[model samples]
Target: MIEEPPTTTQRSAEVERRRAGELARPLTRPAGPIAVYDTVTDGMTGWQFLRTGRWLAYTAAAILFAIICLFLANWQFDRGQQASADNAVVAANFSAEPVPIELALPTLGSYDASQNWQRVSVTGVYLANEELVVRNRSNSGTNGFEVVTPLQLSDGSVFLVDRGWVQPSPTDALNPDSIPRPTSGTVSVVVQLRPSEAPLGTGSTTGNQIQSITLPRIQQTTGGDLYTGAYGLLNSQAPAAEAGLTNTQTSMPVEDVGTHISYMVQWLFFALLGFFALGLAARKVHRELNSDDPEERERASARMRKRARKPFTDEELEDEEIDGFLPLTRWGLSSGTGTGSVAGKTVGPTAAPRVVSPAAPRMALKQDDDAGDREQGD
Candidate 1:
């Protein structure tokens, strides 16, 4: 047996078939960095539209954050303005003329600024027997006890007078013959005004530890008039040698804004940082959005095609057309002259299965002649 090699037409046909198959495959261009970056300048095109959508979402969120930050900044600004106003009020009141002791007493309510200032005057007489010396009183830089005395005023109204600064705790305490006390009938005194219940800025408090001369608290304990707000200093530090009464010292000034200014600064800083960061993030998203990533759309198309059950390859479509055993050449299916089915597998259409017998085929010409002769004889 001689094996025959493929002829020129057969070889050309195979080449053409291969070319057609290759042509049926879709062409795709790979992305380059320059091409990806070029999208940034193109505004919107192809995959750029998808990036634009994402950018829109980022912009919306950025705007929202910006609005929140601006609102917080404005709040801080308003707080700062309020603090400035409060400081101004304190300064103005202190600069105003000193009210007289008599008039100021009755007019304390008329001027609410008295609460913020510590030194206003009051008309009262010093008590000789009951001047109490308070410990740990500090003023300016000096440390002493606040000398407190119940003053019986000329009008019979009693006032707790805080006479300014006395010497710190005395050295000797073992065997004392006599302690100092004050002897006074009617003498003018000067004092610093302070809250009856002032906050201890620092230090630990012992349980039931006695705190020294506080006016409003003393008023609560002693049950006296709440109207009198000023305190006076005594001339002597010790209890009068004759009366054995000691002078008391107290120092209070109320013109501090405390930590409110610092709080306002912190709030403003947060607001600024928020808005700045939001803007930066938005800009980044806007830039990156123009880069390509159309994988979502490709996936969507594939899903649609899967639902429709469309053929993705030309050979598969051609095979379906030849399912009725049509001749391969007529239907553009490859004839199995170069390929053949083995067992039950169908290769090409050259060895197509059929039920009709070719050896005992009926002759169309004989049948037509027999019909014509019978008709003529009749």
Candidate 2:
């Protein structure tokens, strides 16, 4: 007579006992292409893992990436430092009490970059005929020209002054509709110090229109003792220019430290993420190789099979040896050999034992068996 199949409850109880037995037994070196288990069994150390060529390549790539990130971080840090220095200079000079031009300059054509925007008082008469228009200037978003008048001091040296910006004539964009004349007599003017700009080499000066406040170039026309190093942005005059002109208001320098710090931090985190990803991948391989679960072991085996299809490198060959060997008992019904028995009970070729909790009561087991048998009959 044909023997009845074992009930689901009985199959489950058998699987639990087998799982417990497998867990209790000491792991032995597995044979075949599976090298990871063999390596673990042989007590391979962490240093040995790093010594592998694949790991060495990964480490080198991470180091290179980290070095690039650090370089960019340093560049941003330097830019932030420079911006801070510029802001400091503006803050110290923009509103300080005015000093005499003689004291501030001491020598003609000598100026300090750090003295930018410093307030200076000077008494001089405007040489209106020698005045020039600085082309391509803007004020309140209107494209215009700045009126640069030569202020001849009592000592006979001339200092250039940028009176203010004025809109070009609606009829003639090349010139102003009208230029307001500076106050005629000895005029006391308060002005901010500014370094003279470099000459724009060719086609920069034409007739009375100039492209920049380059003093030496302007001195070519005016021809006297000229302050070549610096000029002035007019603040106020005792007897200001006739009603048509307004003082040019210079914008204050911003003191904000931009997003460089944030970008620096993001790059550092990216460098760290590369190492984290490597660690996670290594852990996944370790778990898959050592797992007692047959499905997990099959997945690891599948990886090895895929790798085998490629021309093997030394590292790949080592990995292949680690993942190829699996125990017949662990494969159970899936192995197709049908040789292993679980808890002294024979399992069929197509039937894999189901795992159940060890704490299941005998009464519950009997109830489940009855239910399964009825279902099988149905």
Which candidate tops TM-score?
Answer: 2
> Which one wins on lDDT?
2
* Model 2 score (lDDT): 0.69
Q: What lDDT is obtained when candidate 1 is compared to the true structure?
A: 0.44
Q: Give lDDT tens digits, candidate 2, residues 1-378.
A: 667866768666664554333322222433222435555324543335555677788888888888888888788787778778888998999999999999999887789989989999999999998888888787778888899999999999999998988888999898876888888989999999999898763664567898888888778767889998889999888975677765677577676767766776877788788788877866665554445546555565555345423443566435434443222334332233222334343444322232223334343345446866799899
Report RMSD (Å) for each prediction in the order shown. 24.0, 12.5
Across 1-378, the per-residue lDDT of candidate 1 in tens digits comes to 545755656544543443222212222322211233434445554434434656667556766765775676566667677766656755554445544446645632232444344344555556656555554665557564555667776766666665444454356321222334544555544433333445343544332222554555555655655334544344332232354333343222233344555665665666567667766865444434433445533343334334323322455445433442122222222222322222223233232222111111123223333665799789
> Where's the lowest-lDDT run of ten residues in candidate 2?
331-340
Alpha-carbon deviation at 106 in model 1, angstroms: 1.5
